[model samples]
Target: MREIELSLNQTQKIRLKRALEKLESLSSKANSNSNASVSISDSIPVNLEDGVLKGHGTLDLNGELVATVCGVVERVNKLVYVRALRARYKPEVGDIVVGRVSEVAQKRWRLDIHYSQDAVLMLSSMNLPDGIQRRRTALDELNMRSIFEENDVICAEVRGIQHDGLHLQARSQKYGKLERGQLLTVPPYLVRRRKQHFHHLEQYGVDLILGCNGFIWVGEHVEVKDDMVEDQVSKPEQQKSNKNSISLEEQEQTYTPIETRQNICRIANAVRVLSILGFNINIEVIMDTMNLSSSLNLDIHEMLGSEFCVLVAEGEAERRSLTKRKG
Candidate 1:
């Protein structure tokens, strides 16, 4: 368990301690049958006759498989490995990830996806704004910064690892330059891979993207418009105004509503509390936490206080217990 440093009174401390203990108890009971936490040098049992294959975080010493790191033991058919709770993000093909542009290379943008190495986003891999399906010319290479520049946050898919390095692609409009949002990072282990990572909270008018690399993006929702339609509508207007002149529509687009901004902060604080408590982070859990705070009429900043944290922990424990019973 992670220790939360807060200016908590004696009563708050006792409640928090009790809540955390309950959470720990529930988690241990649920995972007891399927998983086992091990420390370095802990001997892992294996059927020697089956000829076990040792994977990462495990070492074969004197015909015994022992853990090389402190983590939970995972078995995949014949392969046995340890999954470290705290580690760098490992990329997988087709996985949606959010990253920041580290360098704008000649034809590719290097992104830091919290991986062992920086991921590459090539100019040729992504769809251009014009929605054209043509070859990337030298002009495209020269105007690469027009698409993405240094330190710009982008969402892309893990294309695959090439000879150069891990490559990312933004073939869809949903998979590019994030704006007007807070980026919160938690341990990758807390964010499990799921079928759908993109969520549009219509009620709050917010977008939540649970990036596979443990990058949580909470921003105002931007409707995905057809590129051809947008181009057709804007071309005539573009001809009327100077290219450098900013339009009123563009200015309004840049301005986020105060209500939406508050919702973003409130949702973001829920994530922070969940991460601090080491709970599994997902869209449902995040929304539930937000609802809990709202029902109590707690302010956004108050969500991070010791009392709210304790309440969240207790609620989580109760939820998990009910889920286990139903199962």
Candidate 2:
């Protein structure tokens, strides 16, 4: 089993292993009777008479169906595929993802989203920062850096996979550059696809983006402003007033609040602890872990301690046991 690197004593290690074993038992019961996991080049047991269709991670070998990767097998009707846990993200249409700009190419931006290849965000696919919709002229192409420069982290959607490559789009206000946050990377399998990925924690004043590509973003909440109306209002004001006369005091006022910053750290640490534990990550589980920390009066740093890790593991085991009973 894969385990995170931690400084664990003998007792803590034993406890953690016991919890992990219990979790495995729970998961094994929920899965099919026949082992769904397979190794590379393993021949899958499929009825050829029923007409088996090979999907991703599987290849036809003479007459037998063989897996091309080591992963769990999933069968949907007659179509069979392997869901590889350690493989690069395989994007589907409309998957919300978070990525960092690797390069600003001619008319497209290359983003590193931990895929087999970098994803492309064409100039035409995104809305202008000022919320203007028009033809993308050479001038717009030249001013691309003004919108998203190199190394800027952006949230976008998987438009589709073309013959050329994977494509992404950010056409709405919600899909844009992220700021004042920490980006956490984990195995893509931990984050299950769901209807809603963008979450605003009103109590904590933080924004969480559970990207389908395993890039998790936790940041201060940013209000979605009506950029079109603001653009219209500011255009006339720009024509009448000087634009470059901002004072240092006004710039300093844009700083994030100390409390909000603390909240951001707390939430981010909670995610990091969960990832280190190799647990399934969701809003409910994350918030529950946070509540656990608070209930025990564990400081933000103490959450990463050996005792806390063991406690979290034991807690997760109990939670899964309860879920199994409910099921």
Candidate 3:
């Protein structure tokens, strides 16, 4: 049996169960139950006479379509594929992903992006800290630690997989090392890819990066500095000026305000609650959850209490029901 992780009393548990049941009922009614899942080697129902095409996560066994993994069956036109929820992330081109640097190898960083293998981010694929556009030299390779050290969290885009392995590139300003934040990991299925994954909550001064790989980052808003070097003569002096400045310890001592810390906790907890409830995690739903907590004036710690969990479940059930009705 699946265990519910939340600490709930009898009444809260009952309410949550009822709310979840209602949600499941509503979902089944809105869509065809053809999304039925099958286990590995199980025969999937299909009209073989109509020319069925086996896709990913499927195998042809004696001219029969068999599921290669345990997952929900999806049909796109004539193609049939199984979408496994508990499997490693399958990277697609242009997907924004958050990963931790596991190794600083020669001219590349090995990133753990929750895939079958570690993703590689080549040094030549990314921009320099000073944003200079030129051929990378041995000095740049020597200074690789300056850009990303082991265990540093980074956000980048999936550049197609090569013979080496899954490749990533951080060519844009937004794609680089993340700092002053918290990283939250949830099941990748909970997060749906949307047109916009990067959200800046101006109200709370928080930057939220919802990685398609299920690694969510909530951090302090960082302003992107203009790196255009207009004058060639003064560049060296400016570089020297930067080298003489603050140490890492001094920068680390710059404390974050209590209010910002509280806000971060609030948003992080909001994501946590949604993930626990198995709700679709999008920016709008996250904002709604955050607003609900703020409107109720609930303590930051109270947001994860049993009562709040039940309330959130009920709210999600109601929200989905209303959406179903509209459709």
| lDDT of all predictions | 0.84, 0.83, 0.83
Please list the Cα RMSD from the true structure of every candidate, rounded to 1 decimal place: 4.0, 4.4, 5.0
| Residue ranges of candidate 1 with Cα displaced over 4 Å | 226-243
Which of the two, 2 or 3, has more TM-score? 2
| Per-residue lDDT of candidate 2, residues 1-327 (tens digit) | 467589998988899899999988877777657557788999988977788888999998898999999888998988999888777677999999999999999999999998989999999999886577999999889888777778988899999999989999988777888888888898887888998888888888788889999999988877776554211100110111233576778757757788888778778788888888878789998898888888999888888888887888899899989987896
Most accurate candidate by TM-score:
1
Write out the backbone clash pairs for model 1: none
Q: Write down the TM-score of every candidate.
A: 0.90, 0.88, 0.87
Model 2 CA deviation exceeding 4 Å by range? 33-35, 40-45, 58-68, 226-244
Cα deviation of 185, candidate 1, in Å: 1.9
List the candidate 3 regions with Cα displacement exceeding 4 Å: 1-3, 33-45, 57-70, 226-244, 247-254
